[model samples]
Target: MPQPAPAVQRSGGPIAPHLRRLLEFVEPGREDVCLDVARGRGPMPAALAPQVRHVTAVDAMPEPPARADTSGRMSTIEFGTGPVRITGDGGPDGDRPAAATTREDRVRHPIGPDRPTIKADATALPYRDNAFSLVTARFSLYTLGDPDDVLRELLRVCRPDGRVIIADLVRGNLAGPERDRIERLRDPDHPGTPSIARLTEMITSAGGSIRRLDVFTVERPIEPWLAGACDDAAADRIREALLDEVDGGPKTGAKPRVIGGELWFTQTWAHVAAEPIP
Candidate 1:
């Protein structure tokens, strides 16, 4: 399990400022059925649950199966209507109750009667066409090898008139590619971060009509940011690079600097909403 970072260091803190703006832009309604793809450990599900009719949170990895206690009652998470259902192929037979072993999963994506958490690939969703009113992917695209395919899938599962909300870290400046390099150092799974223009272009290329687009920057502390590293060596390398940048060795696009005696950097985030073009 990853150690918890301070709220401020983690995506502008809980209920992040950008997220609040996203919710405002979405204007979720009581009758809306939402699909949150590649939710990971973000707070989107919990934030949307209270406002929407139902929320289905999906991730590529499956949680351990949840078991019924001796009394016959199953342990349940608070957000959803029932126990979490884990599926390998997003098929009926693959569906089964799963228990979340990690503390992060338990708190961020609990299975309940209303919300059903599923394990399935984002490139190929398991839902029928135009199944949801709101389809969202938050901070998930940078990790995918085929983000374009995932974007198409998001549009496929979304209602024609519904919104597809995609929020991700965008390259801020000329050094943005360097920032991506550093991020990949921390987590090799990250393919690359995109510029705001590229992100919007992707939506259009995926047959989506852009409804709204918002971009903002957040300052993050170095230690907490490195907490998600693949291992100690990766974290150390990232740290050394940042420290070097701070010492004026070379510009890393990370914009590393000293803030109150702590190393900090900035990340530009882009939040976009689009509708499937018929």
Candidate 2:
């Protein structure tokens, strides 16, 4: 199984501030319908709702789907927190049990008011074509297969003149050795991290007119990452897999030439905004 994301580290402080500043270009008012592709836990939807008529949160796997409130409107949707209770029989009153019957599938209760979440994939959206005025994928395109194809799909569903925005990690600024390490670890599905130039090419090739492109990085401490990785064994596997690269090429406790100081790795990201062909 793939490893879970590293936990949030308070030591590095909040990384969103830099991201929020870059998001200023996406005006909520100009949008009527918004779609968040790979909307992991719904934070983007909550951030976007006030600016658009409505927002749809879609993900490949939504552990516990977020439900709408009594009025069918939620201030936020706390998604990916954990599994949902199968309200029916397996456990009580003769209800039909859910497919996920194990304890690993369950988690603590939701904590905030949020929007609804739809379990779906990015490349194949369930909604009809021309359904949204804006589409945003924050730092998610790295793992997608054929990101250009994903952008094409986003454009396929976007209204003419509607916008498609993608934010992801960029590798342009890294040192030669660091860049080499990243390239080596990247798989086809992962595509490694992309540079701003590469990002622009992908969007342009997908037939969207580029509106704006931005580059940014998040500063984070290494401690929380170590802890979060501990949650899943796969994370340990990744650490073991990369030891040779990280430890200066094969069992050398000495640091790699790329990483010079206390800061382990610099998280790089990019954002691109484009519009459908009119």
TM-score for each model = 0.72, 0.60
The TM-score between candidate 1 and the true structure equals 0.72
Tell me each candidate's RMSD, in Å, in order.
Answer: 13.2, 13.9
Best model number under TM-score: 1
lDDT of 1 at 50: 72
Error of 1 at 109 (Å): 13
- Candidate 2 per-residue C-alpha lDDT over 116-188 given as tens digits, one digit per residue, 9 for 90 to 100: 3554556766667788787887655644345776788888888886778776666564323444343333321
Cα-lDDT of candidate 2:
0.52
After superposition, candidate 2 runs with Cα above 4 Å error: 1-15, 61-115, 173-177, 180-190, 228-264
Q: Mind giving the per-residue lDDT tens digits that candidate 1 earns over 1-278?
A: 42432232223335544455557656678888898876353456667877788887876443336888711212221111111121112111112224422323322233355444666677877788999899988777644337898899999999987889887777744444677788779878676777777888999999998877666665667776666678999988887888898887877887777877877776666678888999
Clashes of each: 14, 12
Against the true structure, whose lDDT is highest? 1
